[model samples]
Target: MSLCEAEKTFILHGVEENFRIDGREREDYRPMEVEIGIISHAFGSARLRLANTDVLVAVKIEVDTPYPEKPSQGKLDFFVDCSANATPDFEGRGGEDLATGISNSLSDAYRSSKAFDLKKLCIMKGQKCWKLLVDILLLECGGNLYDAVSLAVKAALWNTRVPGVKSVGIDGKNVELNVSERLNDCVPLDVSGAPVMVTVCKIGEYCVVDPSAAEEKCSSAALVVAVSQGNITTVLQGSAGSLHPTTLMDSLGLGVEVANQLNIALMETLQSAPPHFDVGFLK
Candidate 1:
């Protein structure tokens, strides 16, 4: 979304005063709603709405051979699809670049061994492993896309249930396996250390989290930080604007602090969420 010069000036003054046009403080976030296991066909799925932004994520698993170098580790691939309904810029192939960027960012955040344990997905030393395909679909764009997508992905992963292997037989060059069909036999994915991403946007001389589209347009720089288990996993500069060393440090600090809070709130919601009959896009 585009903002006029006067609108940008107004947003900047609000930031300088630690008050946004929406009457929120610098660290305040918009109201959020989350639903899990919403897609019946997916192994796991989640839908998250942060204010006007909406994101859906699904996890599917398949049996595949483990990588030669990391025979004990399985694979995880991230894919992001931006629907034409999200925004005018997302129509046709316009969102391809943003989708790719989000996918890559997610991959980088989860690449660290401490962020996600791939060994949990291994079925055998080298012959068999469960490959997780994480698909993220953007249904709407209100702003703070990175943070919203990251939260939905983490929730979807947490909801994923990996099939149990009933039996495995290996010959010299071939292997046979029996996967359990009982739904109760599935194993839940462990996402305790999954990273939570936060975007800190610099407006005027102050930084803010969960910036609206108009607020985003007023900012010249932004930093996307992913934190897991109280450790910073990834720190990406998302804008072309360069930040001073002090501003960069402050932004990182804010990102980590906000991420910690977000993680706690997200887990609380996931654990307490009741069965949802109404799932999918909300009109």
Candidate 2:
């Protein structure tokens, strides 16, 4: 993502004029396509394409003993795999650092109880709980990785269905549970407060949302804002250069506004998504 001095100057000028190379406004985002329930074997899955960046998220659930400290709450883990198919740089363990960063950001965003209710995943208080493993695969990288990954993760969780526990039996020192046999009886996860990330890139004196790879390269500093139901869940700064306090505040405001708008649009799209089909990279 290296850029020449002249290229950086050009991008800075474009930001000043409020016109990007892609003809989008500073606050506007690229076109996004979302598909849900694309994986049959998993409890739920979704694929999201934001321009050239592609992400796939799958949710798997398992019953296990609840954590001693948070007995009433279940566990949520995030695993990100940057496939080599996305780029040659991701071959072998080359992408491990990036994958770890993304996964850690997701964990921070969803750690707040206000963002996600883990208590609902508890099956029997401290005795049993449902552990959800959210696996994210980065199939492509065009930029704005944080935003794309968050959106795909939210969509997958929205489509996830947890089987209903019919009953729990205690015989001697053993405990057995019965799950609902009918698929329709399963309960869908509540994803109303799932976080959506918005990356605010500082180009010269102005800030932009959803920057392309080129724009990102020219950015002096960037903030990855995670918004959940109008409240900010996390704020992470990645700076190539220093930022003024006032400018940072302004960028935060812009990121929150854009993230709210994105969340609304994403919810509407998810509600109206078509039935599951085989539309992956093959399409």
Candidate 3:
């Protein structure tokens, strides 16, 4: 949505005062709710609601040949789908560009060995491996989609349970594998190092985390920071506006600080959550 000059001024003034339109501090985030194992058909699934922004993530695993260049490692792919109803910008073909950008950002964030270890997904040397496809569906867009998507993706990966292989038989060039049918014979993914992203928006001279839709329009530029294990993984710039070196550094610092806090809170919620059926997905 386009903001008028008056609305922009109001948002800018609020940012300058370190208070947002939603009554959050500069570094404060919106309230969030997370539900795991939301998709019964998928191996792993999670739904996250950050204020008005909603995202659903599912992890689907398949047995496939490992890349020739990386024989010992498995493959991980990210795909983002934006529903037309999510936002006006998502209607028609406009959302494809945004979806592609978000997908690439997630891929970059998870490329590092410290971020996610693909070696654990390997089944048999170069012949057989587990390929994880992380599918993200955007159900709503209030703002800060990068952070919402990253959080949901991490939660989904944590909920994933990879089936165990009972036996692997090699017949020259052919490889035969038998996966365990028992539901209890499954291994959960290690997501301790998974990255979480935070969007720091530059409004006037100050910066704010988790900007609302109106606050986003009033900002000149924004930085998407992905942090893994308390370390910065990727920093992406948004909008055409340029930033001064000092501002860039400051934004990065803020992003890192908020990402660490977000990660801690998310882990605490996941660990303490009890087993329950997910009813949010249907809505």
Candidate 4:
């Protein structure tokens, strides 16, 4: 399945002309499909398919005591699962390491105060706080996992609806949950400043955004940047081999530019999306 030297040169030549192998311009985004509330079991859910990369996000909430250090803030946790459905290499526990890596990276990307407002999720100062468990499922790894996962996270957060509470009663150190008469009423989470991740792959002497699987194999290095309203939330450098500092910086610059465009397109799609939209994989 590997490309020959001639085919590789053809790809490079196409990039030099500002047109890619798939006839896409540098700023053009691949066709994407998004679905919300797909999983009835989860409180909030979203499934996004970016070209070939498929991602599923689920949000679960629980009531728990706030942390001692941050009693006024709630919690938002990220957990990534690399399912075997994506590839045979991830069968059993073999993909645990990669799953942990993705989850930890997301934690670093979204834990900052500027990325998400956790205080808004707090109910009581030190007594009760809402803990959000954001779980991500990697159904397919076509090329860009970071970008796909971030998009899914934003979509899931948009679909999240927290139940409204009327009051909290405490008696004999036991807390009672009193919800409003409108049990079906829910409030949506704010996601204006949510971070969007972009990956820039360095191939030959040029950098490319949203590289294909074959292109990724030929790349010497890559940079992943999570941008929240033009601010950098997370910076990650990955490569099959080593890279120089100059090249790394150059790649990061390219990543930032690509990230901005990605955010704009995602927002546009979400704004015009309909409630009963159909998102099929075969599409």
- Overall local distance difference test of candidate 2: 0.89
Clashes of each: 0, 0, 0, 0
Compose the digit string of candidate 2's lDDT tens values, residues 1-283.
5789998888899999999988888988888888899999999999999889999999999998899999999999999999998977798889999999999999999999989999999988778899999999999999999999999999999999999999998887666889997999899999999999999988888899998988989888899999998899999886657679999889888888988898888887777655484223211
- What 10-residue stretch in candidate 3 is worst by lDDT? 274-283
Off by over 4 Å in 3: 277-283
CA lDDT of each prediction against the hidden true structure:
0.90, 0.89, 0.89, 0.80
TM-score comparison, 1 vs 4, better candidate: 1
* Residue 272 displacement (Å), model 4: 2.9
What is the full ranking by lDDT, best candidate first?
1, 3, 2, 4
lDDT of 2 at 189: 90
Give every collision pair in model 1. none
Q: What would the per-residue lDDT of candidate 1 be over residues 157-217, giving only the tens digit for each residue?
A: 9888999999999787889989999999999988988999999999998999999988888
Each candidate structure's TM-score, on Cα atoms with residue i matched to residue i, is 0.96, 0.95, 0.96, 0.90
RMSD of each: 2.5, 2.7, 2.6, 2.7
The residue ranges of model 4 lying beyond 4 angstroms of the native Cα positions read 1-9, 181-184, 240-246, 279-283
Question: Worst ten-residue run, lDDT, model 4?
Answer: 274-283
Overall local distance difference test of candidate 1 = 0.90
- In model 1, how large is the Cα lDDT of residue 108? 93
**Candidate 1 error regions (>4 Å):** 275-283
